[model samples]
Target: MTDEPLADLALSRSSLDRVALERRRSEVLSELLEDPRTRVAEIRGDRMQVVDPGDRAAPTAPGAPSAAKASGQDASRACSAGALGLVLRAPQPEDRERLVLHLGRDGDGTAYVGVVSPGPHEDPAQPGWLTLRQAGEALTRRDAGLFTTGLALANWHATHRFCPRCGAPTEPTEGGWVRRCEREGSDHYPRTDPAVIMSVVDPDDRLLLGRGAHWPEGRFSVLAGFVEPGESFEAAVAREVAEEVGITIDAARYLGNQPWPFPSSVMIGFAATTRQTELTVDPVEMAEARWVTRGEYRDLLREGTVRTPSGISIAKRIIEHWLGDTVESVTGGTSPRW
Candidate 1:
């Protein structure tokens, strides 16, 4: 396995420069829009349009096991032509008034655009609208960056149409990078909520996993919670672990982070050591909490008694890191029903 840096975590790398200054120029923006080499990732709701290469649009099965697979050739084979399938097309006629985001250039120097289409209807079959969760693992690194950036920007636009300062409707500017309020003259940028997710380990080398109140019975994952207004990531991790499972932890070691913008959140990963092995799971946040040896955890995964976040999620990445190797079923197959 290649030594992948934590920053290169799934949905992390991007070739885009985000050229904020250039986004302010109308002529420059118009030129990019007219460029035939520019590809537009049409984001509607939580899904973005990713051109399929031969295969039909396979929206990830809701309950399918996380699709975390190897990157490079493995990821390429998983999704046909992955990035090659993403063909740039001319903007549709009605897309004129919609938000347009600048995603920057690819390695080949082809510009990428992200078009935001907000409405009541989101048809997965209408074309390339694939959920980030469904298509994320198979996407090439550059494509991951493009798709995720687009989705994040689009999601922010959908929810923040009005200014929080003055309650006035905002107008899209800076190539859809910012929204300007007419009443307050304030510029609103995209918002990303920072959330900390951690793998809590005991002195016995056992890993802590928990089932959320709303999760399925057999599913369990590492403890995670959003960072409050005045809390740091480490503080949030400790507080969340304590509140959810009543476990006091030591220092939080930063692992990595992934952009999880189903509605906008950056999942920061950490490895936290806990002196308290006893679990007092909060019934409101989590249904149960337990510690398991690596072997037991592997067996539970193989037996279909437990499930973690998707392969593309940082949660699974942190878990695999703690296991000292990737955790796969003994059969080397994905459990779609889990």
Candidate 2:
């Protein structure tokens, strides 16, 4: 729980275990989206059907909760009016799997989900109330990001009700995969943005950290920026390092990626080494940059002295790698409060 990104919250399903949208739209529509112990209703707008406290399982059964599908007046509409925007998170592995949800249509007919998974790594309960009376506010950002995938799919149906190129409205086809444009001229589908974040490790195995001027006092995290077109990920990493820290990165290696949905950003993690050079910081990108020692970092984690990224992120991973064994015993193994 070292304020770094903890990406493995939900199991990372491989293609073998994945259920694709185009191929299994029927399975999704027919099967309950949530566990059988919970309730399922149409998730339009940004609301979710909350399970009554009495309906929730006791503390013993941590993962046995089910979502029973509803069929009443409350059945047709999304519960609690949706909160986060639906995101199309598709992992194109050796085999590809995509998840879609219904989102509301913009006035211009564009579909949007309010938030994405790999975003700021904020707390689920951190935002504003959905309904005016605050009667049904139960979705966590973690779950909201998950449920929004479905909501975005829904909104895709309403607005994509046409084709952009031919001015022909599209209809749901292949369960919910392709929206066949009215004229069969050209059908348009949903789109996702690609962004990269890196966790650079120097020759000494110390993580390279930088703090944007706007971040919290004493809080520092990894260097990250969007990947521009026409450049490779390695190039982006080098360019970003140069722009932010004025240093050249040596070897750039891929680690993993997390879905960040503050409007859909994929956090690409990496490990890289930098050549010895004078430290320089870009005022726009970072205020300070340094290679913190393990001993120095241990104090931050144990005493909770330094402001760091929330424990649920990549920055924490880099630091954990930085602190190694010392962090293992911090906080009496209570998941290390980041």
Candidate 3:
């Protein structure tokens, strides 16, 4: 069905709750897992890369055959979604010479097998790890971004196996969805940190942007920061703009958001309209802040003006929306960006 995601082998995406995923026995899941005709795929970068779903030997990750002895192959592959989690989705080394296997923990506990290999475009793990492009494809090219969701959920669950309140251990349940603390009877749900992603626009329709102190050379993006506890989203927006640029936002227009699963965050997107256009730079937070006119921003985007945020990030979406916003709706009947 064309209902699949953008078919990105490497993009950050959320997961689809397989509502109809019949709860099968471990044997059935195993049997169906490697079936040749199982219309399935693997999540990478937030996108899905199709792999052959047939019961065949897939490719091997860095430590093949003996996944136990691969030097520095101990799980935490590179942290989580955004934290450098390094998970290898290598297939078997024998048989089907062309099939692919995912790097999954086997049932026997003594061996690690490729269990998630599905669809057709899956790589052979010839190099043992997915490349940056492949990672991006997996994150964005797929339908509904599953790779990021799966990996993020899995990573958080893996790291939080212990309870904080009681110092007791927890176990994975509900197909790795729920964590029930054994000692405290506490049920911990997945956590998604809240962040303010705003497009601070001046009356002249120029969008405000800044370069962070630690960003790469010539790299710049919209202002964004995490929202602290007990603070309203709008308050966070006003405070952030003031703190970062010395401007105050009078109104906030809610924009859509994207689930940034890089270790679990829900970016709250907004377009903050401010009449005051004074420049205030926080040496500790940003190197500089500037206002760009609609015409100027158009040129900037056309000529690669400043470093923009990732396409998958809400910051980018908010910017895109304002860039094309109707002149009248953009606060003062003025064009916003150049």
What is candidate 2's lDDT per residue for 1-338, written digit by digit as tens? 13344444211111121134433354442232222322222232444334332343222222333442222222112233232221122121211122233222323432322221221323324222122112122233334434434444554455566687777767654446457777865656655455667766666667677888887657777888888989888889899988888889887777666544334455676666776546789988787888876766766666765655533345555556556652436644323222
Q: Stretches of candidate 1 above 4 Å error? A: 1-7, 52-87, 125-128, 329-331, 336-338
Provide the lowest-lDDT 10-residue window in model 2: 9-18
For candidate 3, the TM-score is: 0.62
Give each model's clash number. 2, 55, 55
Instruction: Give the candidate number with the greatest lDDT.
Output: 1
Candidate 3 lDDT by residue in tens digits, 1-338: 01122222124343333432332222333443454433233333323332211222333443334221111221112222332223323233332322222222222322122223323434434332333323432222222244454545644664688987898998654434557799878877768898988888878878887888877654656788899899999899889988998878889877656566667877777777888987879899998778887777656545544555543455655666667742224333222121
TM-score of each: 0.86, 0.57, 0.62
The model with the greatest TM-score is 1
Positional deviation of 271 in candidate 1, in angstroms?
0.4
lDDT tens digits, residue span 1-338, model 1? 12343645767866567677777886665787666556666666776545444542322332233223232333323522244233345555455667788887755767778877657655545444456676677676777888788888887887889999989999888887889998989999988899999988898989999988988887888888999998999999989998998889987888878888777899998888988888888999988888999889778878877776776688877878877666554426664222
RMSD of each: 6.1, 12.1, 11.2
The list of candidate 3 runs beyond 4 A from truth reads 1-15, 18-144, 301-305, 325-338
